[model samples]
Target: IIGCSIAFNLAKLGAKNVVLLEKEKMTGMGSTAKCSGGIRQQFISPANILLSIESIKIFKNWQDEFPYPVQYALDFRQAGYLFLLHSKSQIENFQKQMALQKKLGVVTVGFVNTHEISTALPYLNISGIVAGVFCASDGVADPASCCAEYEKQAKMMGVQFLTDVKVSDIGANGTTRRKIEVVFTNKGSMLTPCVINAAGPHAAQIGKMLNIEIPIICHRHQTIATPPIKWMKKNDPFVIDYDDYAGQEFYFRPEAGNENTGYQLLLGGHEDGKIQIADPDKYKEKIDQDFILYLADRAMNRFKEGENIQILTKSGIAGLYESTPDALPILGKTEEVEGFILANGFSGHGFMHSPIIGKIIAEIALSGRSSFDITGLGLDNFKTNTRPPAEKAIV
Candidate 1:
């Protein structure tokens, strides 16, 4: 998703011969396809809020900016995102966080009282929910279609896409190490002055080609979908159980309304103790039996439903999170590598941050810097013994 956007922005900036290389047969058919399908701006971190705030601007006006032949919309429904709060401490935390979010230009994120949450989602059992943090601008969208449209617009602007391609090696020729000279792929070689590492889950291996070790690991995240049910309203904001926000609990939304899927509820569990995979290619794509049983039981209890509800995990799907040590993205040029810019390692927020990262990358490629400050998110944070504090606001 970010790669296609980068190509589009580069072309718009009057760059000649921008190209995209995808290892998969199609763009966004890998990890991005299985994304949570959310474009939310409700965040505790300043870096994440900045990225989503700018990204939402482009998404809100996507059709006008990137017109396509197909009659497809990004399906951005501003239904809102409701995080159920369990404790007074959580409410206080959200009160403080919402202030920061608003100060960072996120006007839609604020605290919604228990009565308001009940009014919006009357079907939910809000006995445990003390209060809620709701953001109307933060809701679900069709990530697959969004990726398709970006790729389409980029292609129209003369961006070349080579699918099923893999990078073998990369090196610089100039003795002073000014810029990237050539990139050797499995099929052939392409000589370019610059290269952006947007390799998704395979980004670490790609960085190894230039002998740069990016501290990113692929962790399998499992999600389950239920059969169509009328209980969940189409306009209800995506819900994150408070207990699960910092622990293993369900984070769910209305499954996208599509031909393949019916009126279903799709959900995922956050397993902090999950084992990280060395390679995404080798990880299993199906949910584990033990996890499936636990998920099914939790699903029924989560919605106060009976066993006959039959929200099964028989056909669960899994994806990889390109996670970093601090769970934040690495999004700038490294001091060691000259022309090889870093735009990967978004952890699990790749789709949400793609818009800002793409524009920033284009700015850096054309000029020398970006308009927005990205110094804290650069590679210097991961340099020798410089580990910063971790951000734990994830589900």
Candidate 2:
């Protein structure tokens, strides 16, 4: 979404020579389609929260801006994201984060005691739940549709897309200085002055082509959908349980049309940490049963609907959740390379922040800096041991 959107916005900014290359036969065939599509402003960092807040405005008013049907229904139930806390320390931490979020103009989040949590979600078993942070503005959407809309808009804006073409290498030229000369691809080479490494999971390999090492690894996260249930039709809010034993887990609104009939469920427990594939060409798609069961058990304890839910589909795909040393994303430029921009590492928050990322990347590519300050996301932060800590609320 970021790549195509950036290409589209660049054209809008009067850039005549913009092109997008997709290794797959179609755009968004990678992680964008597989995303859990949760959009939230309840983040630990001010930058993330601000981006999310701005993106929500775009998503809500998508139809008015774009010609084609972006299918702009956020289905955004302000029903809130309930995060259960089991420890006193965790509760205090959440309280601090809530205060920070509020200070940054994200006033939709707050700490709720076990009694309030049970009141909000009566079906929940709050035996071990001590406190919960509820963010009413946090919601979900259809990632596939959003990606398609971005591609459609880009195409309409005259951004040429080359699909089924793999970028083999990127050549640089200059005597003392450096400039991207040509992009060697499977079909042929293309001469371009600038390139964005929005290759998703394959970002590291793309960076390696230019002799730059990007700290990005691919992880397999599995999600399942359940057959329709009567009780779930009552409009259950997207629930997340963070009990000490429960760890991190999340469940969101169903797919756009299937919300009443069935709902999509996601569970992330890549116990193997992350599998590093040396070659991006060699990728695997397989779901782990043990991981699914672990997530199922966690969900069943809190949401009664999960207890008797019948699995309708089970599949897994390889997506890049680029992890920094501290698990936050590594955005901005690298010192080793100029004219080569990096927008790769998003951890799992890429899809939700796609709009903001697209605009920021386009701004950087066009104006050398984003209107919103991105100084905290520079690649140097990782090397200097000042990487921002991972947001505890994300699952």
Candidate 3:
């Protein structure tokens, strides 16, 4: 999605001769196909919040915003995102973050007490919950539809796409100067002055070909979809058990349903301190049995109608997240190389941030810098080991 969005924005910026190369037979066959597709602006980092705000604008008004004649449905929902807070410290931190969000023009975000939360969602067992922060503008969308629309718009704007073409190496002019000259791919070599590293989970490998150490690693995450239930609320908001009580942190949201299936949900989360660093190409694609059992038990413990829910095992999927040290993306140009821009390491927020990041990267490629400030997301921070404050919201 990021790559396609970059291409589309580049074309929109009047840059011709833009070409997108995909290793797979099609675009969005990697982590994008497996993402949970939650879009929210509740973040501690100002940079991420700004990116989300910009992207959500497009997601909310793509028909008016995008220049495509045939705009596809993104299946976007503004049912809101609620964070279940348990501790006083968590509440205090959220208060500060919510204030920052409000200052940044996020008027939909507000604090909700435990009673309000229970009143809103009657099925939820708010036993240990203290308070919650809800963002009415935050919601979910269909990742596949978004990517398809991006690809279509970009192609219509004269951006060329090459599928089943794997990039093998990057060539520079000389040892003294770092400048991109050519890209060697499986099909053939192509000469291009600029290259954008939007390889998703396989981004580090691409950086290695240029002999630049991209500070990114892949982590495995899984999500599951449950069969439709008659009692399921179609307009239910996306809910997150923010506090890691008993080492379990779960999140769930309603999935679109048909007449046959009344209403369903998509649910998953991470266990506290369980970091499964994985190979992007070699990791397990199926969810673990133990994890499935754990989610079922956790759901039953948290919701009144959870016991009646049945997991669609075949609907379970796992994907890789190209993560960074501070839970933020590494964008902008790298000092080690010229004509080589970095747009990697979104840490699982790639789909949500794709639209704005696409425009920012196009600005960097065509012009020298982005219209938005990206000083906090540069690669120099990792080199000097002086990073900005980490983003606190990651599920």
Q: Give the winner by lDDT: 1 or 3.
A: 3
Instruction: Provide backbone clash counts, one per model.
Output: 0, 0, 0
**Candidate 3 Cα lDDT to native:** 0.88
| Residue-pair clashes, model 1 | 0
TM-score of each: 0.93, 0.89, 0.97
Off by over 4 Å in 1: 67-70, 176-178, 244-246, 258-262, 312-314, 384-389
| lDDT (tens digit, per residue) of candidate 2 on 106-221 | 77887777788777666667777777778878777767777777777778778899999999999987777677888999999998878888888788889889888888766556
Q: Which window of 10 residues has the lowest lDDT sum in candidate 3?
A: 63-72
Query: RMSD for each model, in Å, please?
Result: 2.5, 2.9, 1.5
TM-score of 1: 0.93
State, as a TM-score between 0 and 1, how close model 3 is to the true structure.
0.97
lDDT of each: 0.78, 0.70, 0.88
Instruction: List, residue by residue over 85-155, the lDDT tens digit for candidate 3.
Output: 88988898889999999999899999899889888988899988889999999999989999989899889
Error of 3 at 275 (Å): 2.7
Model 1: per-residue Cα lDDT over 1-395, one tens digit each: 87887888787778888889987789997789778877777777788888888888877877766646645567887888888888888888788878988999888887888888878776666777788888888877787887887788888888899999877888775556556889888899998888998888888888888778988899888888777766776777888886743556667788745544435788777564664474777878887776777677666666755364565567587789898888888887877678888888888888988877888998988897999788678776776555445655666
Candidate 3 versus truth, CA RMSD in Å, comes to 1.5
Error of 2 at 44 (Å): 2.0
At residue 336, what lDDT does model 3 achieve?
79
Ranked by lDDT, the better of candidates 2 and 3 is 3
